[model samples]
Target chain A: MERKVVFAKPEALTDAPTHYCPGCTHGVVHRLIAEVIDKLGIREITIGIAPVGCAVLAYNYFNLDVAEAAHGRAPAMATGLKRVQPDKVVFTYQGDGDLAAIGTAEIVHAASRGENITTIFINNAVYGMTGGQMAPTTLPGQVTTSTPFGRDVKIAGYPLRVAELIATTSGAAYVVRRMVTKPATIASAKKAIKLAFQAQRAELGFSLVEILSSCPTNWGLNPREALEWVEENMAAYYPLGDYKVIDEVKSLK
Target chain B: MAKILMKGNEAIAEAAIRAGCQAYFGYPITPQTELLEYMSRRMVELGRVFLQAESELSAINMVYGAACAGARVMTSTSSPGFSLMQEGISYIVCSEVPAVVINVMRGGPGLGNIQPAQGDYFQMTKGGGHGDYNVIVLAPTTLQEAIDLTILAFDLADKYRSLVTIIADGMIGQIMEPVELPEIEPPQRPEQPWALTGAKGREKNIITSLYLGGLPLEKVNLRLQETLEEIKGNEVRYAEYMLEGAEIVVVAYGTAGRIAQTAIKEAREEGIPAGLFRPITMFPFPYDRLDEVAKGVEHLLVFELNAGQMLEDVHLATRDRLPIHFYGKMGGVVPSPAEVLAEIEKIASPQRGER
Candidate 1:
C-alpha cells in the first residue's frame, strides 16, 4: 500500500539548520516567510535584506538572493534594491532594536517616500543577539540586562507602537500587528505577511507587518510559557489588529 | 562634446551621468550641493534613480544597495556629510561592491567652516572607517581634471568591485572652468557573479561584510589586501613639471598642487630651479616616483591647505634621505602664490643655518 505525505518543509527554505534557540519564535516567523514565498512562487525573484540582529544570519536559511544591511539600515537598503530592480520583490526582516530604535529614521522616511517594498518587523521586546538588553519596545516594567532593576517608565520612556506610528504615514498602504501564540493566530500572521507582499507586488506602496515574537531565552521561560506570555502580556499592550489598510490594498484580495 | 563653462560641482554631476551611473543618492551639503542639485534634475530627466536621502548615512547605504544589484551608483557630499558616511563606506568596501563617492571637502574637526581644505587626506587615503581596508582616492587639481576623473572613477570602481572617491576641495567645487565633456559611454562591466539580482537559474548570491570566525575574517582581509596590492601596482598616477635640472621639487595635490604650479613658475623666473610633482592618486601616493624625484632634487617641499596632512606620506616616501620642508595654511586660509614663492626663496637663500 502507498502512503501520502501529510506535510513537508517549504520549498523556499534551504536545507540548512537554523541557529535560533530552542524556544525562540524567530524560527517560526522564518518558516512563515518561507511558506509565503513558496505560496506566491516568487522564490526565484525575491530578495531578502537581513538586519543586524539574531536574524542577521537569515540569509543562510532563505533560498533566495539576500543582502545583509548594517544595524538599522535595512529599510534604506531595501529601498535601493527595489528601486534598481522594480520587477523584483524585496523585503527586509528586522528585529525590534534594529527597526524601532537605531533605524527609526530610515523606516519613517522609507514609509514616507511610499517606497514599494515589504518589511517584516520582529518585536520581541529585547535585543536577543546582544544577550537580552532593554529595547525601545521593552515593556514598562520589564527587566533586562540594561534595565536590571525593572524598567522605569520615567527613565526609559514607554514602549513604542511601531505599527500605529507607521500607519500614520500617508505612503504606507498596509500596516498590521499580529502575534503567533496559537495555531489560529499563527494562521492570521501568515495571512498578514502574504498581504504585505501582495501589496508590494501590486505596486500600491509601502507595507509592513510587525510580529510580536517570543524570546524564550531572554524572557526566562520555556517555549510553552513564552507563547502564553505573548498571548497574555504582549497582545494586550500591542493590541493585535490592522492599523492601516489603504483602499487599494484592501481590494488586493 | 563642445567645451562648456561649468562649475566644478556641476561638472562632476554631468560626468557621472555620462558614465552610465544608474543610481545616485545624496544629501545637500556645502560646495557639493550643486552636484546633488544638478543630479536631481538631470537624473529624473534621464529616467535614472535619483534620491535625496535624509542624510549621508542613508545616501551611502542606498548606494551600497544599488551596487549590490550590479548597478552603477554614486553619492556626493562634503566633510561633515562624509563623516556620517564612513560606516556605510566601510561596509560597501568590505562587501566588494562597486560604488563611487565624491567628497568636495570643507574645513572640519567639528562643524568647521565651509571653506576648501584638505584636512581629510589622512581619512581618505588610510581607511577612514574602522577596518583594515583601503579606498581608491583620486584628487583632481582643476575642473577639467575633476570631470575626467569622475568618469574614470566609475570605470575603476567596476573593474575592481571597490570604492573610489573623488577628493576635491571647496575651491575646486565652486570654481567655473571651460571643460570638454566626454562622450556618453557606458562602462563595460565585468561579469558580476555575486550581485543580488534574484537567484533565477542560479544559486543564491549573498553580499555581506560579516565573517563571524577569526579564520574566516582573516581570509576576507587577506583577499582585500591582495586587491589593494594590485591597485597600487596598476593605478599609481602623477604629473611632473620641469624635473630634469631642478634643485627643488614641490610636492602637492588638488588645490594645493595647482597653487604650487604658480609658485614654482615664479621660482624658475628667479633662477631658483624649482619644479612641481603633483600626485593624482592620493591612496597610491606616487611613492616610487616621489622617491626617484627626491634622488635628484636638493629639497622636497610639501604644500597643502591643511596642517601638513600629506606631509606624513612624504616623510614615508623619502624616509629622511632628503630634507623635507612643509608650508601649510589652516582653517580655510588659502595661501597666495606670492606667499608660497617667498617660502621657496627662504629655502634657496644663503642663510645656510636658517633651516
Candidate 2:
C-alpha cells in the first residue's frame, strides 16, 4: 500500500495569512486544530468560537465557520452554540488571560455542567494581547509588566493550576496539558486535539486541552530563548500530562 | 389556540419553547428565577438545552454562542444580573448575532429590592451596552402580550440578525393572567452556509466581528446604523385608548400601564377627560404617535415604577409640543390607581393649588 501524506492542510483553518508575530506558537496551534479536523473528517460540521485578545481575528485565519466571543466568554458561547445545534462540532479557542481570568466562572461551570464542547486553552502564562501583563498562570519569581519586581508568591499567591483543578471536576470527560515547542510535543498536541474533537463527535461530555505555548514578544526573550524559557519556567507550574480521562474512571466505577 | 391563566414568568418560558427556542442559559435572579426554573423542568422534556450558568455573564455568552450556530437561544435576569451581562450583550450586538434577553425590571443602583420597578427604562431604550448599537425592546403589559411579544422578539431578532429584549417588570413576571398559547414554529434561519461546524462537503464559514482598520470597521457600523433605521421606520408599536377626544393622556408601559388604565377609568368617572397611551415597543419608542397625540392633548402624564426614568422619554416626545407631568414610585413600590389619579387630579385641577 502506498503511504499517504499525513502532513497536509486541515480544512478547519483558512489559508489566509495569520497575523501572529513571527515564531509565535499560535500559528502552530491553529495548524494542529486544522489537522485534527481534517483527520477526524468533521471539518464540515465544526463551529469554532474565537475569543477576544490576540486571537480575536481567528475567524479570518480559520477556514471553518468561526464566531468571535467576548473576552473570556468563548467557553460559555461555545456551550450555547453546541447545545442549540447538538450535531455541530463546537470548540472554543482561548488564551490564558481570557480563560483563567475574566472567564474563570464560565470555564468552571461549563466543565461542571459537562457541556458537550471542546476547549483549546492556550496557556502562555502572560496576557499577550494586553501587552504582557502577568497572568493567573504566571510562575513564581517570573517578571511581567505588572509584576516587574518578580512574582512574589506571598504577595500574589501561588500560580493557579487550572488543569489540575479542572481534573477534579467530574463533569470533564477528558483533561490534558501538552506543549507545542518541539516536534514530538507537537505530535502529542495534535493527537490531544484529535481526541478532543472525537470525544465531542461521540457525544461525550466536556473536554479541555491546555496547550503550553510561548509569547516570545511578551516574555522579554528571543524566539529561541522564549521556547526554552517556557520549557524551564512554565513547565514546572503547568505540568504536562493527562490529568484525567473519564472513560477510564467510568470503567473502574 | 386555548387561553389559560398563567403567571407572566411561566408564560414567557412557554412562549420561548413554542417559538422553537432549543436552548436556554440563565442564572437565578429574583423575580425572573421562575423563568429559569420553568425552563429547567420543561427544556429537557422537550429535548432542548437548559443550563443554570454560574453567573449571568456566562449565561448570556452561552446564549450568544448558541445563537451564532443559528439556534434560537435566550436568557432571563433582573436588573443587577443584566448589568453583569452588559459586556457580553455588547459583543452580541456588535457581532450581529440573534438572541433574546428577558429583563424582569427590579429597583437598583445596586442590588436594590426585587419588587417590580421600571428603572431600567433608560438602560433598555437607550444604549445600555458600550457601542453605537440598539436592541429591539418589547414591553408587554398583560400576560397574553408577554407570551405574544416573546415570540415576536425571536422573529424580529432573526429577521434583523440582531438581539431582541422583552422588557417587563417583576409585577408582570409574577402576576397571573389569561394567556392564549400559540403553536411553536421554528424560525426561518438564513442558511448560514458560512457557519463552521466542519468542512465536510462545504467551504469553511467564518463569523467574526473584528475589523482591523478604521475604514472597514466604520463600514460595519454604517451597515448596523442602516439596519436600525429600517427597524425604527417599520417596528414601532403602541396602543391608543380614548385619545381621540381626550384632554390629559397617561403615558405608561408594562404593569404601570395596567395601573394607568385603572386610573383612566376613575378619572373618566370623575368627569375628567383622561385617556391612556401604552407603549409596547420601548426602543423604537412610539414617538411619532405620541407626538401626534401631543398636538391635541393639553397635559401628558407619564406614570412609571421608577423615580422618573420613562418620564424623560415622555418629556422628549412631548417637549415644546405640550406639557408633560411625571409621577413615579421607586424602591420596588408599585403605585396604586388612586395614587396616580391623585397626581392626575393635581395636574388637571383648574386652580393650581399650593403643594
Q: Score the docking of each candidate (DockQ).
A: 0.88, 0.72
Clashing pairs in 1: none
lDDT of 2 by residue, B1-355 (tens): 6779998899999999999888999999999999999999999998888998889988888888877777788999999999888888888888887889999989887999899998888888887989888889999999989998999998898888889998988999999988899875566666655444555676666666778889988999999999999999999999988776789999999999999999889988888899999999998898778888889889998888987887877777777577777888888999799988888888889464235
Shift in Å, residue A65, candidate 1: 0.1
Interface RMSD for each candidate model? 0.5, 1.7
Q: Candidate 1, residues A90-148: lDDT per residue as tens digits? A: 99999999999999999999999999999999999999999999999999899999999
- Over B1-355, each residue of candidate 1 has an lDDT whose tens digit, in order, gives 6888999999999999999999999999997899999999999999999999988889999999999999999999999999999999999999999999999999878899899999999999999999999899999999999999999999999888999999999999999999998887567889999999999999999999999989999999999999999999999999998787999889999999999999999889989999999999998889999999999889988999999989999999999898999999887888999988888888888483255
DockQ of 2: 0.72
Cα RMSD to native, each candidate?
Answer: 1.4, 2.5
Model 2 misplacement above 4 A: A1-7, A248-253, B184-197, B350-355
Evaluate residue A210 in candidate 1 and report its C-alpha lDDT on the 0 to 100 scale. 97
| 10 residues in a row with least lDDT, candidate 1 chain B | B346-355
lDDT of 2 by residue, A151-245 (tens): 99999877788888788887898899999989999999998888887777777788899999999998878889989987887887788999988
Residue A56 in model 2: lDDT: 85
